[model samples]
Target: MNPAPDPELALEVLTDLVRTDLEACNRLIVERMQSPVALIPQLAAHLVAAGGKRIRPLLTLAAARLCGHRGQRHVALAACVEFIHTATLLHDDVVDESALRRGAPSANAVFGNKPSVLVGDFLFARAFQIMVADGSLRVLDILATASATIAEGEVLQLVTQNDTATTEEQYLQVIEGKTAALFAAATEVGAVVAERPQAEAEAMREYGHCLGVAFQLVDDALDYSASQAALGKTVGDDFREGKITLPVLLAFATADETERGFWRRVLEERDQSESDLDRAIGLMQARGTLQATITRAREYGARALEALSIFPDGAERRALAGIVEFCIARAR
Candidate 1:
């Protein structure tokens, strides 16, 4: 059997493989985010500088390379992917009323919700500009549809929030729209830029879709199981928000009547106390819901690997596979 993959090492390998392209993408991100409004760039830069892993953009660059792309188009497109992602983050934080991001005060917290929303709009506009400059209606459609799907996903999450009866199918739909849509677009656009066959492009999209699902699943598990330092955000943020993630769903599935009442009071009623988060975690631990969530993530990760099998064996393919492992390893 393959040795267990290291999340940090897998991430580092993929980052190193696309180091130069990633640098160019970063520079482009800085340049495009600038505006005379001052606050636009300042607030935008705050989140950019806060520095998440840049996994989406990295996927774009790596996907292009894997498709044998030689042009510089992938760099600019990668930046576009990041702009779209950052824009979503800005909007999401406002919606979630999240105070912290990447271990720092979120933009909405620092700049206020109004500016955060507007800057997020500005970033979306910037992403469109990049897409237009690429002059490919196909790429534009892919990313634009993703943007809309993300909004729809967020809205769907709102509909399901505080409701313990959310089905796994509904949860999957929400995540597909909010999280996986852009991942699908990011990787698909690489193939488009490389002028690869449609079959290849679809394969990449499949890989990304599965990977995004896996990534978000692990994130949900970590919310209840990991430290703030390790998670890069507050633990129990989802619980506090009443978000019906997989772990919560799994726990609820097996909950006795008393435990069900506890979930309802905390999640549906939002009547949480200081001890509630601890109790929630304890219940999840006893139910092994966290591990069950991780197991679900691994299943999606396996599908992501299968999607990559269409491509030939090479460093790019391995790097992409490593990404799948990296995402799943977070829960372990």
Candidate 2:
């Protein structure tokens, strides 16, 4: 039997791969932003300058390298991935009325909602232009489809917001569309550009879908568990906005009418107290909702690793698998 793969070997490969991608991100972004339109350059630079984990771009780069691609298109594709992500964030902050992101004021907050939205449009156009430059109709198709799905997901989430009756399954579908769709496209496009085999390409897409699901799971968990200092946004911000995330949904499912009423009042009326947030947390803890939510994340992580079998065992495959571990490890 091939013994279980050592995580350390995976970690080493993942760390090195991610580091190389991050190092190259700034230069590549700048080089690509030399548009004739000055505003496009300015807006793209502003969003790119606001540092993120660069996880999406790294996923593309690493997947390409894993599939044996050694071309400059990987760099441009990575930048396109990040541009799409940033554009979503800019629009999200506007819709959510969010004040903070990644430890800084959201673009909407700093530059006003008008500029933020317009700049977001600029990024989207540039992303499309970059994809066109790649000369791959397949890549453009995946990204365009993912972009539409993300937009639809955002609207779906808006409809669900402040509706206490939003089911867990509904929530999952929304997240899969809004979050996992882009992640799936990012890695899958990498494989496609590398001319990977059909089975391997499908596996890479599944890998990204599962990783994205796991990553969003921990984002919900952290809202309840982490401090404002760590989260860079207010703790319980979801509750404040009446966004019923996974943990809360799980807890509410088992909650009695009184507890349900409590949530209804908070969500529908937006009339929450410190005590409301505290009691909600208490109930979730007592009922093991956090643990239950974590269970779901682990299941997704397992599926992500399971999707890697199509790729032959190698450092690239190891690193791709390690990313799943990183996602789940965030909760612990």
Best by TM-score: 1
Clashes of each: 0, 0
TM-score of each: 0.98, 0.92
Question: Candidate 2's error at 231, in angstroms?
Answer: 2.1
- Name the top lDDT candidate: 1
Determine which window of 10 residues in candidate 1 has minimal summed lDDT: 1-10
Model 1 TM-score on a 0 to 1 scale: 0.98
Candidate 1, residue 197: the lDDT equals: 97
Candidate 1, 203-254: lDDT as tens digits: 9999999999999999999998888998888888999999999989999999
Residue-level lDDT of model 2, residues 99-182, one tens digit each, is: 988777777777788878987887788889988988899899989999999998888888888887899888998889889999
Off by over 4 Å in 1: 1-5
Global lDDT of model 1: 0.92
Scored by lDDT, model 2 comes in at 0.82
